[model samples]
Target: MKALVLSGGAGTRLRPITHTSAKQLVPVANKPVLFYGLESIAAAGITEVGMIVGETAEEIQEAVGDGSQFGLKVTYIPQEKPLGLAHAVLIAREYLGDDDFVMYLGDNFIVGGIADLVEEFRTNRPDAQILLTQVPDPRAFGVAELDPSGQVVGLEEKPQQPKSDLALVGVYLFTPAIHDAVRSIEPSWRGELEITHAIQHLIDASAEVRSTVIKGYWKDTGNVTDMLEVNRTVLETMERRIDGEVDEASETIGRVVIEKGVRITNSRIVGPVVIAAGSEVSDSYVGPFTSVAENCRIADSELEFSIVLRDSSIRGVGRIEASLIGRHVEVTPAPVVPSAHRFVLGDHSKVQIRS
Candidate 1:
C-alpha cells in the first residue's frame, strides 16, 4: 500500500506566519507537523509515499529529500492549486494506481498515530474508511450523518446546518473504487471538489463506506490556538534529559529536555518544556508547556505556554503566555515613557481602563 499526503493549501487562518512558511512545516515541539504524519505512515508499514505540494513545493522538497530519513521512498506530486481533498486524489491517480492507499493531511496531528486504523482497514478492506471524531463545532468541518445502526448515511462539507456532530478527521483509507467517485462528483459551492462529497457519492452508489469514531487526541493545527495546544500535548510526553550546560545558578524541574549546546544560567525552567540546541536562557523563567526552538535567546523574561520559533529572541519582555512566535523574530521590552490616558468619547459612550 502507498500513502498520499496533502501538504498544499494557503493557510489563511495562520496568516503572516503561513505567508512565510507552509502550514504543514510549522513546528510543534520543535518538529514540523508534516513529519509527525510521515512518521505515522512509516510506522503503519507503508514505505512508498506520494506527497502533494503546492506553492511551497520547494521548501517541502528540501526538507523531505527522498524521504529516506523516515524509511519511505517519497515521490513529490506538485498540485498547481489546492482545489480540494478530492481533487488531490484525482491528480494523484497515476501515482496511486490500483493499490489501496491512505490519504493523510500534513498539518493534522493524531496523538496515538494511525497504525491501528490502518490495520483495521487492511483487515476489512472497505471501499473507503474514514476517521471521525465528535467536535464541538461541526460547522467548521466536514460532518458525517449516521443511521440508527451507526452506519454512515450522509456527508457534508462545512454545511450551514450540519446533520451530525462527528467531524471527519484528516486521515482516510481508500481502495481503487474511489477513482470513479472522484470523477463522478461536481464541485461544491466553494468551487472545490470536497472529499466529503466524493465519499457521499460512494454512499449513494451503494459502495461500502465505513467510519470509526476515534476517541484519541487529534488536532488540525491550523491557527495559533490549535498550534499551541498541539505543542503542549507533544511536550507532555517528553523525557527529562539535560545534555546542555546548566549553571549552578539555574534550576530545571519536570520533563525538560535540554538539547546539546544550550546554556542556562540563573534561570528556572519548569517542565514539560523543551529547549533546543544552541539556545541560551539567562535570568529568565521558562514555565511549563513551553518550547524554545533552536538558536533562540530568552533573557530577563517569563515565558509560559508559548512556542518560540528558531532564531527568535525574547528579552526583558515581562511575561508571555499562549503565543506562537515566528522564526527570526525579536521580542523585547518597549521603551519606558510617561504614562497617560487620553480618550475622545461620544455621547453615552463608556470606557473601562486598567493599568
Candidate 2:
C-alpha cells in the first residue's frame, strides 16, 4: 500500500505565522508537524508515498526533499489550489493507481500512530475507512452518524447541526473503488469537492464504509491554541535527558531534556520541558510544558506552557504563557513611562481613580 499526505492549505487561522511559513512546517516539540506524519507513515511499512502540496509547495519540498529521511520515496503532486480533500485524491489518481492508500493530513497530530489502523484496513479491505473521535465541537469537523448497529449511515462536513459528536479524524484509508465515487460526486456549496461527500456517496451505494472510534489523543494543529495543546501533549511523553551544561546557580527539576550546548545559569526549569541545542537559559523561570527550540535565549523572564521557536529570544519579559512564538522573533520588556492619569471631566460626572 502507498500513502498520500496532504501538506497544502492557506492556514489563515495561524496568521501571521502562516503568512511566512507553511502551517505543516510549524514545530511541535522542536519538530515539524509534517515530519511526525511522515514518520508514522514509514512506521506502517509504506515506502512509496505521494505528497500533495499547494501555494507553499517550494517550502514543503525543501523541508521534505526525497523523504529518504523517513525511509520513504516521496513523489510530489502539485495542486493548483487546495480545492478539498477529495480533490487531492482526484489529482493524485495517477500516483495512487490501482493501490489501496492511506491519506494523512500533514498538520494533524494523532498521539498513537496509524500502524494498527493500516493493519486493520489491509485485513478488512473496506471500500473506505475513516477514523472518528468524539469532539466537543462537531461543527468544525466532518461528522459521522452511525446506526444502532454502529454502522456508518451518514456523513456531513462542517454541519450547522451535527447528528452526532463523532467527528472524522484526519487519517483515512481508501481502495481504488473510491475513484469512481470521486468522479460521481458534485462540488458542495463551498465550491470544493469535500471528501465527506464522496464517502457519503459510497454509503448510498451500499459499499463497505467502516469507522473506527479512536479514544487516543488527536488534534489538528491549524490554530495557535491547538498547536500549543499538541505541543504539551507530545512533551508529556519526553524522558529526562540533560546533555547540556547547567551551572550551579540553576535548578532543574522533573522530566526535562536539555540538549547539547545548552547553558543554564541562575534559572529554574520545571518538568516536562525540552530545551533544544545551543540555547541559553539564564535568570529565568522556565515552567512546565514549554519547548525552547534551538539557539534560543531566555533571560530575566518567566515562560510556561508556551513554544519558543528557533533563534528567538525572550529577555526581561515578566511572564508569558500559552504563546506560540515564531522563529527569529525577539520579545523584550516594553519601555516604562511615568505614571499619570489625564482626563477631561464632563458636567455631573463622578469618577474614582486609584493613586
Which parts of model 2 have CA positions greater than 4 angstroms off?
A: 346-351
TM per prediction: 0.96, 0.98
lDDT of each: 0.96, 0.96
Lowest summed-lDDT stretch of 10 residues in model 1?
A: 155-164
Which candidate wins on TM-score?
Answer: 2
lDDT of 2 by residue, 1-355 (tens): 9999999999999998898899999999999999999999999989999999999999999999999999999999999999999999999999999999999999999987999999999999999999999999999999999999999999999999999999999999999989999999999999999999999999999999999999999999999999999999999999999999999999999999999999999999997999999999999999999999999999999999999989999999999999999989999988999999888889999998877
lDDT computed for candidate 2: 0.96
Enumerate clash totals for all models, in the order shown: 0, 0
Question: Per-residue lDDT for 1-355 in model 1, tens only?
Answer: 9999999999999889999999999999999999999999999999999999999999999999999999999999999998999999999999999999999999999999999999999999999999999999999999999999999999989988999899999999999999999999998889899999999999999999999999999999899999999999999998999999999999999999999999999999999999999999999999999999999999999999999999999999899999999999999888999999998899999898898
Clashes of 1: 0
